[model samples]
Target chain A: MDYFLVSFFLIQYIRTSLQTAVNHPEWEKRLVFARYFSIAWIATFYIAEEPFWTNWVWDIFLVWLIVVIYRNEVFNSLRTTAQTVMPFVAISIIRDFVKGIFPKFYEENDSFFQVAVAFAFVLCFFVWFYARKQMKVLQKEREDRLREEQASRAQKESLEYLVNERTQELTMQKEELQRTIEELKSTQNQLIQSEKMASLGELTAGIAHEIQNPLNFVNNFSEVSAELCTELEEEIEKSELAEEDKDYIKQIIADLNQNQQKITHHGKRADSIVKGMLQHSRLSSGEKEPVEINALADEYMRLAYHGLRAKDKEFNAALVTDFDDTIGKVNVLPQDLGRVFLNLFTNAFYAVAEKKRKLAAEGFSSDYKPEVKISTKKFANKLYIRVTDNGTGMPEHVKAKIFQPFFTTKPTGQGTGLGLSMSYDIITNGHGGVLDVESIPGERTEFRITIPVSEPISQS
Target chain B: MKILVVDDEEDVKSLFEQKFRKEIRSGQFQFSFSFSGEEALTYLAAHPSEVVMILSDINMPGMSGIELLKTIRRDHPSAPPQVMMITAYGDSANHDQAMQLGADDFLTKPVNFVELKEKLLTIL
Candidate 1:
């Protein structure tokens, strides 16, 4: 029986020590010492048949637990270390007390204790295995949750990047759309301006055609009448008329000649105006030809004045020109440049006419003379032409948008609203020049045209 | 010399007669008046040998001056009578086309009668 007890205790000690070593690898040497001590005490309890030495087993196991706690440093706080060690110490002391009191009963029920120990060992092994499986499941769930969180964060970042890119793209597209709208507006204005010019040209061309026939007849009849008058005078001289009668015939012939001269002069003036209108209406041939700039400006200025006079018999203004004769011949499309000058002159005349009418209405006859002055200069490889009117000058607002197409301040039918805009285009865009305006309210308005001396490298 | 004045305007006939009244009275020249191109053609056909010169306006009723010129050039290809074209439009295109159609001279109105008389003397 004692050998059986010795063998059983030795096996339990070896198994427990092996479990400790397996649970904590750093406690391997200490657990081995504890195993030998347990075996020696169990052998003493069995061989000496004494209960006192068996009490040493509980005390030695308590010491071994302390050694495990110190060597592993498993508990971070003293209270936790005490809590972990106190349970085993209490159970071991109780077991030692029971053994001390039931020494004789222990010897008789040794198989009962061995059966309880074996059952306890089986229960502990089962509990340890179940706990290990539960811990593995929990660890796997946490890892999966972490992976899911990281993937979602990455997805959120990608979505944010895509949204930012879309916003930038939209902003860029909006800017492009704005630019396109601006370009379209400019193109539309140009088209409207061209259309207006085209129809006006067609209308003027028809009128010119109709008027030329009558003008030709008037000129022809005047020449014929003048010739007949001379012939009649010669006949009177040959017929031996009285001195008084001859003198009367000569006087009548001279008067007739003067009337014919007036008719011829006015007819030529009308013809020139018709020609100017035709020139304005016709399409520019875009052929560069030599032009006398100052002479051309003066001619158009006179024509504009005469044109207004034909319309309003009472309308008159002082016309002045300071021409630079040195600007003899510049290469330009004569019809186009002529149209520009005609438009400027007409505007000046209209402004002066308006001011004159106003002054006449107010009855302020203190010599508020309406005057238009044209001047030209050539310097620094450029030709500068200026047209000034001392009439009702434009305000700041009117001067600001004077070049925009279809923007006009004149009473509806009196202006086509395209004169200055077309003139601006002709000088600036067509000739690669600059058109500038300087005006003061109720004082004066001046339009300046600056053209480069050299021709542009490209036509378009 | 016999000359034919073809014009749509009736006054041109009297004007021409009045202008050359001295020459006509002296028997230096003879003038025939036709109101239209077809009338001029008919006159020419009736007195082909009598008509030495034809002055026609390019813009006219019935047959145009260009057509008349072409017809004269085509039918009388050999030693044809001199034909001069007159137009109110001074555009070069019409002048060129008229000259191309075998007109002897081109003039734009209002015609210079003195220059025309000089040209007529040269031609005769």
Candidate 2:
């Protein structure tokens, strides 16, 4: 009986210790020492012929060791340990009950008790094996759930990264599309403006042709009438008339002569206007010629001044010119360059004239001499032409939009608004030159044109 | 010298006559007038070699001055009359076309009569 008890206790100890070792690997060595010590203790108790009750003491110590090793899981460990020892405890109770009920039967069938104890041990071992299998199933389920969570987190992070990359690409494409749209809008505007200019040019050409013929007649007849008046005076002097009559005829002739002079003056003005219109309507001929630049500049300056004078007879400004004698000739589109010079000179003269008018109106008596100055200089490979005027200069906003088509400061019907813009195009696009402007409001404004002195190789 | 002045305007004849009255009265020169390029061409065909110079306006009815100039150059190649092309449009294109079509001179309108007389005398 004692040996059976010792064997059952030893099996329980080994099973519990292995379970504890699995739960806490850091206690594995301690558990191994405890196992060997219990075995030695059981052997010593057996060899010394100690009482069977002493084995109970060793079982209690093993339970205490399990409690110490699984401190936080003491109740769970105790339950498992109890399950391991339950069958043995139940078999012992059944044996004691049977022995108490029939003392002689129990004394004669001692081997039956031993067989019953062995059967209980086999059943306990099977129960422990089944429980261990269940634990392994629960552990596998936990590991699978943890692995699935990690995989899902990784997938979520990658999805976020992809979303960010796509968003960045979309933003860049949107910006590029916006820029292209702006470019398209500007190009469309330019097309519309050029179309308008083309139609205007055609209309001007027709008007110029229709007007020039009659203008020629007016000019011719006026001069012929003036000559006839002179001849009539000569005839009247030779006539035998009273001195008062001769003087009266002479005075009439003089008045007629004055009228004829006025007619001729205005007619010439109208003729020049027609000429300017023809020049404007006739686009550049795309022919480059070696022209005397100084002579061209001087001619346009006088033309601009006279054009203005014809309108407002009292309007006058001092015209100053500093021509570069060294710049003898330049290969350029003479008509186009001449148009640019005329536009600059006209703008300068108009500015000074405006300032002069304003000063006179305000009765500002200061010696504010409204002046328009033109200067030409020749550098190594470039020719610079500057037109400066001390006049009512523009502010920042006006200067900013000066080169834009149809942006004009002059009153309606007085300005076509295309002069400076067309001049800008002629200087930059037509001649491959630079046109720059600088101004101080209420003080002065200067426009500078820089062009290559030599003919471009492509033209040659 | 007999010069033919071609124009679409009818008043041109009177203007020329009055402007050159001294020359005409003195019998220094004679001026004839044609209202259109076709009429000028017909006059030239009828009075071949009689005209010393032909002053034709470029923009006229029935036929253009350039076309008339081409015809004159083609038909009277040996001793074609001096043809001067007058245009209101003083553009280089017209000038170039007139020059290319054998025009002796090209003038822009509101013609300076003084300059025209000098040119006529030089040509004669």
Q: Which stretches of candidate 1 lie above 4 Å from their native place?
A: A1-208, A232-289, A305-320, A348-371, A389-401, A438-445, A454-460
Model 1: per-residue Cα lDDT over A211-252, one tens digit each = 977887787777777778888888888987899989998999
- On TM-score, the candidate that comes out on top is 1
**Residues A353-414, model 2: lDDT tens digits:** 88888888999937889899999998878989999999999999999999987666886445
Q: Residue by residue across B15-118, what tens digits does model 1's lDDT show?
A: 78778888899988899998888998898889877888999998997899899899989988876999999887777789999999899999988788899999
TM-score of structure candidate 2? 0.53
User: Which pairs of residues collide in model 2?
Assistant: none
Relative to the real complex, the DockQ score for model 1 comes to 0.35
The weakest ten consecutive residues by lDDT in model 1 chain A span A75-84
Model 2: CAPRI class: medium
